[model samples]
Target: MTDKDLRRAVLDELDFDPSLDAGDIGVAVSEGVVTLTGHVGSYAEKVEAERAVRRVRGVRAIAQEIAVRYADAKKVADDQIAARALAIIDWSVHLPKDAIQVTVSGGWITLTGAVPWRYQSRSAEAVVRQLSGVLGVTNRIAIEPRVPPGAVKDKILEAFRRSALFEADAIKVTVSGDRVILEGAVTARAERDAAERAAWSVPGVRAVEDRIVAMARADKMRCTAARIRDRSSIPETNARGTDPSGGRKDTKCSDRGACPVA
Candidate 1:
């Protein structure tokens, strides 16, 4: 559909009175993908607005470019990065407690958070991405940095210790300040997922940037990877997924199946 048609569709579907007026919401549509722009007060509001647009018929994908601006500049600097980060985490329904930290310097943003699951780290990223005026993000989040390197060797090792997802000693793990990088050849997709989960579990980590090369022994990687789920049940599913019969088209996957069914 045309961009105007998409904007009008989104505007019609969104019900909340955003902190800002409807005119402030910038809508861009190209090739059926809709992007929401402009500013809001809270990340939750920004998300609801996106949901509104996705509910409209003819929407294929959504790119949320909504910014969360502070009520006042005085509130910006006064809210320390760690404080702001924690507050964001505390306020978010999806983020976990005792898994994240915030570091800000002259406007630069650094997230130091950890979680047992790689998905949690990803959730933390999404949470911070909506913050207003986030200059740059230095993700120092790690997965399982608690284990001794001499003992664990790599993420695969740590994952084995915790979740039994992969070999304990097969994966290679390295830490450079806030970045925890993982590398190794694995036989299955679960092993890769385990490595990523371990990397994200470490405290004081910002980003578990992985560079591991997969060496699937059998077709397990191919078979298991297909079972990986994208969205979670914590956040309410976009009703757009289900048709009148509460059934959605099997082919209606996302750009990356990241938000399958809408």
Candidate 2:
């Protein structure tokens, strides 16, 4: 696609996403690389903008330059933001409250602590980024695996076998220390992401490096995109799109957890 066409397509995709207010953001394209500029209400919105663009074809990579400038004139104290951040994390069942520590300075919240799964770490960030005074969030939380390496591999493989979403034998799972590596090819993007999530669900997984590739089939890509678009539509009253008990990521509906796809 021409640079002009690619730029327009990206801008339109950003406009179509319901989880963010794209008004202040600017889109620029050079070749296949997409760059985002301007200001967003929060760091969460900035992330949403990039994700929206990635769905479009011909996007080689993303350079996110958007700034998080809280538009509220009423200046909020760092102490207040810290207290609110703690409250938000405490209330979420998906996060272990004692496992997360929060600190705020200049409206930038920094999270430090250890969690078992990457999704929980992402969930903590997801919850705090929507708060009013947050200019940005720095996730310093680390994953400390709790399960034995042998058990972790078994757990992930069992999860894959139980689910009919994709073929289990086609994928390979490797564990070293607390890190899990998925190396194989899948037929769809959702299936690839599902494998990552399955690996994270195991108790002792500190990191999940998704080296998984998908077959370069046009029909598969189209179906995968359609699935993401359909699932991302305005979630129900429960802000987190899926149940915490569900195998999917335990995500909050307000931020990256839930988004409306067009």
Q: lDDT per residue, candidate 1, 4-77, as tens digits?
A: 87677677666354432555678878856788888766555666677566446566557888876556552446
lDDT values of the candidates?
0.57, 0.75
Off by over 4 Å in 1: 1-3, 16-21, 42-44, 63-68, 71-74, 87-99, 106-108, 122-262
Residue 174's lDDT in candidate 1 = 67
TM-score of 2: 0.69
Candidate 2, pairs of clashing residues: 146-204, 147-204, 239-253
lDDT of 2 by residue, 116-216 (tens): 77789989999998888778899999887677777888889999999786778657788887888886555554566678888887876877887665543
* Candidate 1 TM-score, C-alpha based: 0.40
